[model samples]
Target: MTPSNTHTRNTHLSKESEQSQINKAQARYRREASDAAAAFMQFWRKTKEESTVPTKYKELMQLAIVLVQHCRPCINLHTQICVQVGCTRAEILDAANIALAMGGGPVFEYIGYLMQALDEFDPPKEAT
Candidate 1:
């Protein structure tokens, strides 16, 4: 084959190799993220189980932390846990307020997510 043809073939192979490498990196990232999520869940469960604080209180504190961190998923999970553990709406609001105070203006944007979580997990009842 001519040199030009050889160069074209090599360029194609290089591009394919680059794509394969990118795919491998993406797969690795996904695997690591899944593993980290599993580990974190295990640690979270163990801590809640063993803590001297009540589960509801722990969930409340977690809500405050997630609010400050602006983690929507954590807010959803912990808000649901709070409701499951018998936390009142008042208690949830209080935790959110404390987080907002501590987190300042940035926290305001995420508080909407918190409210949406509350609505999703513990919607108000209609009057009889």
Candidate 2:
């Protein structure tokens, strides 16, 4: 084969190898993400089931911690769970206020996001 043809073939092979590596990395990332989600779900269920604390209080505490940590997804999840566990809006708000006091300014900013999640998951009742 001509020298130019050999170089072109080598370049093409290198590109294919790079693409293969990228595909492998993406697959690994997806698998890790799935596994992490599954593990988290298992841990969440076990914690709720085994704890002596009532589920509502646990969810409230989780919401408070997530608010302080500024984890929007956790905030949403725990808020939804809090509602499902029969926690009143007032209770949730009180927990949020405590979080704000503990976390100060950063947690205060996230309160709006928490409210948005609450509205999405457990909107207020309309006036009769």
Look at candidate 1 and give me any clashing residue pairs: none
- Tens digit per residue, CA lDDT, model 1, 1-128: 99998986886577468657766886787688988767876886798983688787888999999999998667877888888878888889889999999999989999987886787688333212
Tell me each candidate's TM-score. 0.65, 0.65
How far off is residue 107 in model 1, in Å?
0.7
lDDT of 2 by residue, 26-97 (tens): 678768798876787688779897368988798889899999999865786788888887887888999999
**Cα-based lDDT for every prediction:** 0.81, 0.81
How close to the true structure is residue 96 of candidate 2, measured as C-alpha lDDT? 96
Instruction: Show the colliding residue pairs in model 2.
Output: none
Of candidate 1, the 10-residue stretch with the lowest lDDT total is: 119-128
Clashes of 2: 0
